[model samples]
Target: MWDAHMHCHFSGDSDASPESMIASAMDKNLAGICFTDHLDYDYPNEPDAFLLDFESYEKKILSLQQEYDGIFPVNMGIEVGLQPHIADQNRQAVEAHPFDFVIGSSHTCDRLDPYYPSFYEGRTEEAAYRRYFESILENIDTPVDFDVYGHLDYVVRYGPNKNQNYSYEKYADVIDEILIRLIRRDKGIEVNTAGFKYGLCAPNPCPQIIRRYRELGGEILTIGADAHQPEHVGYAFDQIPALLKDCGFNYYTVFTARVPVFYKLPD
Candidate 1:
């Protein structure tokens, strides 16, 4: 399997070096991996925090790719934080780079990042969750450049009660709109295993959403660990094959130079 979403020191939040992350993926026997470091322009309270230094970051990735050539495949990718206002900026950022894969993600709700407890203050969890899903719809409605939507239910990971009160059924209307729009746009979603790390006991968007996506004629699906460190590189990936099969997917996807490559799920 390939761990398509990963971060290194290039992503402001992660301290892991790219080499260490690739080495860890190798140790785990992954077929290949992608380095999707963050390029979250205009992050709340820290606008420049996740801005990627493309020159230096690309240099390091190129150097390592040469050294590890034939040993393993290290694909270059980025995770862009999507917002309605900065849709043009996000598109420009992706166009300027030759990233193999791009993950468009909603990291904020009306400029407020749900990561902070303050985001949940004074609001019912259901209300906050609805607003988050609505923001995703707005983001995708714009012309942002991205291949897959990252962590469809990321906000729930930080909600006051986390996923305890969350269910795809509770918010099926908006979520279905999001899925249908994505399929129409030829976009895909990633099964982010980070949810398991955050105590959700399932991947982001959960199995229910994945099954719904398939039912909606969504064909492109990617699986990623969303790892920021070596140990987490491919975290819980072993459970993916079975989980995806249960969701009506017999294949998983990877990207190269922005093109989808399908691989049959291992039996």
Candidate 2:
């Protein structure tokens, strides 16, 4: 198994150290894992914003690679929040690193994090959802500089009106545009299973969107648990093969030096 997205203590929001996370992956018999620590730049309101110490973190990851070479394949990765107005700053930060994988994410919409209820103040649930999707569409056109876009529908998982009805089909046009832009830029998308943990039937960028991406000439896809804790690593990975097969994707993607490499899903 390959867990393409995860975080360790090197990231601010996570407390799981690299050693502990590697041990968990080893216990699960994963073939490889990537440490995609948070790298959100200039996120307002987060004083000690969740971020990784890139220089030191990369050094430590390289050291661990030597120690665990025979046990499992470990890769250095970073998860960066791609905010529209700060694209330049975010791009500069990523260019400074020698990451094996990069996951671009959008955690804030219009400078407000939907994770906080205040973001939805005075706005109807439908409007709030629409704004979130718009934010994604806006950022998609701003020269993305990462391997894959993370949890495209992450806002839904924490929306104020959680049970509100919304699906990819409703925003297929916008999503198609986003996928095409990514494909043109040689970027990929991730199937984040964290959605299931939040009571949703499917993960972010639901199966419908996955199918849409494939239909739109997208072949590279990555599966991630978006784990913040050791136990969460590789969660529900057993179902990934079948899911990819169902979406007409025979291969899953990994990265090294920020370049994508494909792996056939085990039969």
Candidate 3:
């Protein structure tokens, strides 16, 4: 199995050390894994905004690489929150590192985190949902700087209203536009299974979106547990092969130097 998205202590929100996460993946007998640590730039009021030591983090990764070379394949990756207004800075920071994969994510919509209920304040449920989709639409055209876009429907995981009513059929036009942009830019999308841990019936960028992406000439896709802890490393991965088949995708993608390489999942 290949898990293309994950976090370690190098990221602000995670506390798992790289060694521990790697050990967990090895225990699960994964074929490969990527440590896509968070690289959020230009967020106001972020306590550790300038405290992430990339040099030290890279050195640690290098050390671990030598230690685990024969046990499992580990890729150095980073998840960058791409802001339209600050794209230049984010791109420069990403270039500064030697990453195997880079995941472009939109965690902020109109400068507000959807995780915060304040993002929904003063807006009707429909308006809030529409705005969220609009933000993703805007993010799609920003630039082509990463291998995959992380958790396209991440907002739904934290939205004030449950995502029961937010089906891809309801937003096909917008999603079509997003998929087209990704295809044109040669980028991929991720199937984040963390949503299932939140009691959500579907994963992030749910199966419907996955099907839509494939239908729209989008072929590259990656599966990630979005694990922040050891036990979550490869959660629900057993169900992904069948899901990809249902979505009309025969291959799942992995990356090196931010370039995608496809793998055939067993049926």
Candidate 4:
């Protein structure tokens, strides 16, 4: 019932307002939503991309939460772009704010924005993908105190083949390493439904990876539409409960004040 990850005008890539997005979620029969606006510390995005005015932004969301008090909980959250150099800054920002949920995401590697094609220059797709994974490993190695890693296989969404030949069997070693570390550290992953919107035919991590996470004893899985606009709020979520159950999970996780709370998957 909670669209755990979404964006608004606060996110560099989205121009939708938070109120409009919340209304759309309500229309979809959602109980709540977390505004995970982007906070990419440094990048080449336009109009000062990936930056948030923490003070102003916090005040705005807190006000919005008060406005929607009796209607539903509008949780304050952020999608942080994981850059090793900015990890400390990120920590400080989170400490300064009252974010209910934080999604650590990798939008770049080797100082290159993967959203652009240049990231694939001078390397095979496999090497590029490996480097992206390596960057994620490094960020997580920052010994992240984050709740969940967003879009584990996000790189695949922009790959030249776009998951046409993508298979868990192909990337098992590194993927397993990633999953194992997350489990060992008590962190979790999200079922980012954005992949379906991106025409990837699956979620950001896809079912194969989700099943592997469950198989490896990783239990704190969360679900998020990752919607950047109002119309996309709670997109294709009714299908996720069965998808999650098939992946060996009966409940999905949520957060409040960074504490995990599990809710049974809907029938």
Candidate 5:
């Protein structure tokens, strides 16, 4: 399996080196892995916190790609925090780099990240959740660059109730619109398994959303651990193939030079 979304030292929030991450993937017996470090430009509170030094970051991944060519495939990718206003900057970043994949994610709503308590301040959980979904629509409406939308329901992981009161049905009107819009754009979404690590007992967007994406004819599904450490590389991957099969997916996706490559799901 391919762990297409991950972070290392190149990502400001992670201190893990690429070498350590690669070693973990190799140990996990993963078919391949991608270094999709954070590149959230104009991040709140710390503007340059998630910015990348593209020259050096790309250089490191390219070297590993060559060194491990026969042993494992190392792909270079980026996860850009999507917001409506930074659409141009996000596009330029993708256009300027030779990344194999790009994950467009909504890390904030109205310039505030739900990851922080402040984002939840003075708002009902349902209201905040709706705003987050709406922000994703705004990002999609803009000219953003991304191969797939990462962690469709990431905000719930930080919610006060944390999915206890959340359901796809509660937000179906907007969530369906998001899925339909992405399908129309030829974009896809990843089954981010980080939710399990976060104690959600389900992946982000939940199994319901995954099934719904398939029901809507959305086929480009990618699975990722969203790991920032060595041990977490390919975390819980053993469960994914079957989980995806039950979601009506016959195949999973990976990317090379920004092109989707399909692999049959195992029984």
Candidate 6:
């Protein structure tokens, strides 16, 4: 299978080069991989911003694809940090590039970086988590030209403490709203296996939410490793196909030119 979401040096948070990521994915014998470098416009307090160099990035990927032709497909993708007000700006950026896929995410909830310890300060964890989910509801309020919403419950992954206690039942209303909307708009959620590497026993969304998505007729589910470095490419993927089948998904998705291609789950 493919590890659909990953980062490289173009994504400000990762140090790995794009070529290194490709080499590692090939070593793992992955069917393919995508480079979804970060693009978050107007990130609060970030000087350089997570905006990607679309021109140079596309050029580099194209050249690399040429070098590794017929090895394994290296798809060019982008991960946009969604800001509700700047939906148009985000649209323009994705449209300007020849990206095969786009992942809409919310790194800053309520104008604060949840990765920082300050995000959890002065508020109950419950309150913070709710706000983050609510932000996603607003971000996807309009149809973003993205294939899937990356890491549905990403906030829990980086809590000052690894969030081992959170449950989907508690946030059913908002989470359901997010799923219903995505299904309604022909979009989908990604099973980001990075959660396991980050110390959570489950994926970014946990299994409960994945089941809920299926129960509610949300069929478009994608699996990704969300690897930031070479060794982590496709990390935890071996465990995902089984989880997807148990969660009511008969198949998982990948994209090309922003269109999903579903592959059946192993028997």
- How many clashes does each candidate structure show, in the order listed? 0, 0, 0, 0, 0, 0
Q: Extract clashing residue pairs from model 3.
A: none
**Candidate 3 residue-wise lDDT, 18-77, digit = tens:** 888888898988888998888777665673552357898888887787887887888888
Q: So what's the TM-score on candidate 6? A: 0.96
CA-lDDT, candidates in order = 0.94, 0.85, 0.83, 0.87, 0.93, 0.88
* lDDT of residue 102 for candidate 1: 96
lDDT score of model 6?
Answer: 0.88
Name every residue pair that clashes in candidate 1.
none
Query: Which stretches of candidate 2 lie above 4 Å from their native place?
Result: none
Candidate that would win on lDDT? 1
| Residue-wise C-alpha lDDT for candidate 4, range 91-136, written one tens digit per residue | 8887778889888888888888777889989998888888888888
Comparing candidate 1 with candidate 3, which one achieves the higher TM-score? 1
What tens-digit string does per-residue lDDT give for candidate 1 at 112-207? Answer: 999999888898999999999999999999898799999999999999999999999999999999999999999999999999999999999799
| Better model by lDDT: candidate 1 vs candidate 6 | 1
* Two-way lDDT contest, 1 vs 3, winner: 1
- lDDT string, candidate 6, 187-232, tens digits: 8999999899988989988999999999999888877888889999
Task: Write candidate 2's Cα lDDT for 101-159 as tens digits.
Answer: 98999989888888899888999777787788778778877765888999988888887
